[model samples]
Target: MQTSQQIVGQFRRKRLFIAAMVAVLVLVLTLSFRFFEEKSRIEQQSRDFANHTIARFDRMFSPLDVSANNTQALVGLRCGEVRFPLIENLASLQTVRAILLVDHGNIYCSSIYGERAISFSEAYPELAISSQRMLLTTDNYLLKGSPVLMLWTPKTLDNHSGLIQVINIELMSNYLLEPTLPWVERAVFNVGGKSLEYGNPLIEEALPSADEVSYEESSLRYPFSITLFGPPPARLALMTLPSQLPLALLLSMLTSYIVWLATANRMSMAWQISYGLTAKEFMVYCQPIINASSGNCDGIELLLRWHNARQGWIPPDVFIPLAERQNLIAPLTRFVITEMVAHLPVMPRCKSFHVAINVAASHFRDRAILDDLQTLWWPANPVPQLVVELTERDALPVVDQRVISHLHKVGVQLAIDDFGTGHSSLSYLKTLQPDVLKIDKMFTAAIGTDAINATVTDMVISLAQRLNISLVAEGVETEEQANYLRERGVDRLQGYFYARPMPLGDFPAWMDRHLAHIAA
Candidate 1:
């Protein structure tokens, strides 16, 4: 018996072989379908061309039948008297070689041989009968060694006199079919078992056998048919394979890439995060947190801004949670802190100036986060007070107790962000004993309109007062909200009414303009 590892290895090899075979089969089927589709398209185009050519021939020749009828009427009135003008009119037509007036099996007048009587039955025995209406013939009779079509109409003038118009075959071939002759290798036009061919002389002499020929036939309006022959299907497929194979492979690759991109899910986001970090696409924005009574700039909250190369300025609400889920929040948080430390010297010089950073709940579970902060903080003397704002989106794990203790020991302040939004707000408040409580924007937006939200805000204020904890009202947009929060003894305020978040580079200019406006 085989060992367990050997058996497992053998199974894996079999599975891999089967998967490879399946992939090859799929590729073969895809290429086969692509080849057949191209072949079908070519066949359809050929059919349309043949049909169009036949229709054009019909339209060109339909008028000749009507001309024959009119000439028959003229023949009935004095056949010998109307002969001169009749022959002149027929000779002027480009396709008409000659017109002859035949009466009782005898030609009395002709366009080429004028007023010369000849035996019509001996010269052309087939057209001797006055009953024969239309005939396409190749025999050399009146034109002498040229193919022509004879259009004869009979009338009862001096015992069955008839008008015969002889049409030149070469003229018809040149005008009607010459332009499109090169489209096919060989083409044969057949009318009443008589055939005229137009194509390459070499191809016509050595025509392919029936088994080796790919031919298409189209019927004309006047008892005629056009047969076109080209290279066999296998030969055509082989000739086109070189050009079409690469296109098929390229299309298959594109289809596979699109499917992979769509189904990659978290892997795609991982790639975006990796590329964004490597490219330094992330930036920091600072929103001013003001003292409610003093109206002085107390501190600023640091917010993450991602400027994707393709999609600009991804909102924190989208990317932050994604980072947390991917276990990449630690690296992202490290990037923010590192950027803040690097720009610390250029920041506005104020004794009480502080910068607060938002932290994911997952970061609390990792002790490495504290190590990273200590590495940056220990080097700078008189560093601005650092506040770590924790949100309630994810619960604080019990394992983070040691990390939280280490942070507090190092003079890092902790604040509960978006208060009253989470499920266990009161429990967290009692257990964590946080330094600041930031009222969520949802509650502040509902202060005037929503009764339940207003009461909740009032209750939060009363509780904060009793606990002696600092309270900050967020999203205070209007004077009414600002005044309401101020009256309730909210310690600090942050919102669009104060100032929207600006890049760190632009903050100093904004601060100067703001302070100047307030002073003025």
Candidate 2:
């Protein structure tokens, strides 16, 4: 008996793997949701900020309400001759880097940091009056300390051209984004040749060349943006803020997977042992098919018996399904095929000798399946006469055609195991034209004992003869059943009456005893 540590370790490993898978799923879902939420929040904040800023500019220009501001009025206001509250109020904000007033192809006043007031036309040579709609425009441009936003509004008075106020605002680094950034860490802009002045080098050159900057820590992000005075400048630059949450989440996911994988790997070997299937540890048993003429045993149907390391003598009925579900059927069938092939070189000296192996219908439909078996068969020491047996039920139409055609081409004989039970067998037999028809033991064993079985057996045998299909009786348990099948012209037979499947080593001795008896 295996120790509890050996037994329980395997189970624990499997569960832990399941737990790990669950954790990965959770991590993915969590990140996806957080990403969606963060993206949505950033967009919403941008919308709200744009709406508020634009509304303030719109209110200032509403009072002007005119198509033009005459040069006299503009010059009077700029030269301290007349007081215009709208222009003065906007210019007074210290964050404003410069203010320019333009009217009717001429400049009125230009102030840079409110220190040097000059004429706009004289200061800039390219100062031709632009026909472009330049009423209340807000945008960002790079400057020394930070990005500066310039808002342009054409102040109009009574349908005449008025001065255009260029209100330059130093872009606030932390406006709507301060809540998302760290306490000590500040958001900075990267100026890849676009030239934005921030205190740190990283912020000055973080992004190669993009207009917006967003820095992330874990699932959270802080956004910093720059707007050009005109249409959003196509070229861009970026930068980031310092944070640690992103690193933590990534490390946690990696550590969780590695630990789970290592533990799961160590546990799998024990699990296989606890529920293991070994060819050597299996018993090869046979059921007899009785002969039509002599009424004695004709052949043995080879069945595998697995003795589990934990549970003794696990039945095929219980484990075959498990094997298929676990994708172990291919390996298991290969084992059985190898063992049976070894039987080919050695068989009893019976008048007729053949061994039947039950196969899942899935194999019959697999063309490559027979080819795979051929590869295994050619090298191994040969076995006695072999019958490639398949169940009548699982074979589907398309699979049936491919399997039957392939089987015939390979010169391998096919027999439908447990024949007459499936309603579709008669039709399948007509098309497939297999070499042998196996009578279900129900019909053979129930003769005279079960009235319906006797009639069914006689009809099935007659049908087999009519179709030129060889008939064999399976699951024959008694001398009476053997005699009954022989009377009814059952061609081959197997049951407990014939020697049950002895071990491969024991089989030779059993055959020698029978030969000795026949010789005597």
Candidate 3:
């Protein structure tokens, strides 16, 4: 049974780890895709601009050689002044920048409103030539638009009169791509094995021709320069990537936090199953607090618990705090004590022995608890002299004394459960002064290995002795701890090394088992 529990616990840990890893992995995958997608989108935008610009320009310059058998009116004002209304018509398209008709050169009868006509020298070398349905800039947006198609047309007039129209839309920076963040100093997307630089190095490196191209992320290192491939024939079209990586990093942080919260909630539920403690459910598992130094027959501690039957055992660590926050601690403690005392006489040796119990300080503050105890004591002749163990954590000094005084007045003994673990144990000692000090499990954890701990133990024992108090060592998991505590004059001890908590019905069987061990 123990092995099975250990296996289940291991599985839970592994599963949580895997889930956390998967969450991180999924985020990484998304980041990888985003990085490349940004690059592709930029490239696609460049191509779209090139294509759109070139298409409209194509119809304007090549208008079927002035029609066949046309009248003087149709060709009115001759070649340079031909009625190429179609050229001006395409300009209405929002995406179209402008249209220019270069008949017999010399910026001959142009209709380009937006694009201020510049000499061939001012525009890149052959950027003015429109040839064979293709557009070529003498110098690429050398910094921006990727060169789409470059072609040449033979001139029919002025020897150099062939139309040369270069197509170029807005730059990627001014158009499509949005920076991932304000702090992203650099973003270099390598998709299709072709590098794209935004807000950094200008010019995308074209890919080696491949049938199918897909980009796989190799590494994503930080804190580096994102300079575009520098120094072009014609400069001025380069800008750095928007410095905004905080947005992406913030997203990662949020993802991690969400995962942490979810896992914590799930584990809280799982622990409820294992321990059977929750807000609404009640459970009890009596365990013997054996004095191993003398014999395995000291007494039993009636551990009252809250279990959420549907959700499982709420871990005391989780639900107890919630109960306290909700102000349910007092009622919970009262209910446990009342129920346990009612069932006391039926347990193994309720008439003959002492049974210690834990009570939250919330109950200690309520005077009703004292009255109730008196009523419970009235019925049974001896009225079970319960060793009321008050947890140090919740035992406030102001009320602890009031409660302890009441318990003493009612003839019930008091024990300080988890003695040295509370933040105010030493301070509270002078005021609240509980009867028995149940040593915290942690002090005994390293008893055999440390001398200072032994000295500390001795000092605590001395303090208890001075106060005429008794010491009960808790969590004596090893014989060594029990021996050490016994040697140091600890009056009682409890641990799994002796026995785990059990149901009251199993008391007789446990005693019988101990007897058999004693005999052996």
Q: What is the TM-score of each candidate against the true structure?
A: 0.55, 0.46, 0.45
Q: What is the C-alpha lDDT of each candidate?
A: 0.71, 0.54, 0.53
Model 1 vs truth, CA RMSD: 17.7
Top of the candidates by TM-score: 1
Taking all chains together, the TM-score of candidate 3 against the true structure is 0.45
Q: Least accurate stretch of 10 residues (summed lDDT) in model 1?
A: 199-208
- Relative to the unseen true structure, what is the C-alpha lDDT of residue 94 in candidate 3, on a scale of 0 to 100? 37
Clashes of each: 0, 31, 38
**TM-score, predicted candidate 1 vs. hidden true structure:** 0.55
Where does candidate 3 stray beyond 4 Å? 1-280, 305-310, 348-352, 375-383, 395-400
Query: On a 0 to 100 scale, what is the lDDT of residue 57 in model 2?
Result: 41
Compose the digit string of candidate 2's lDDT tens values, residues 1-520.
4444444565576657666776666566555555555555554554444444334444433433231233234443544433344346444454444445555434555443322244544433222333223322223322443344333344444212334444232243333222222211233321112223233322233342342433322111111233212111111100111132365357556766766766664345333532454436655665545455754445667787777654465566556654554456566677777776666556664435666777776655456457656787656634444677777656455645777777777666778888988768887787778889988878877877888878888888999988888987877778898787787777887766776756654665666665576567
Arrange candidates by lDDT, descending: 1, 2, 3
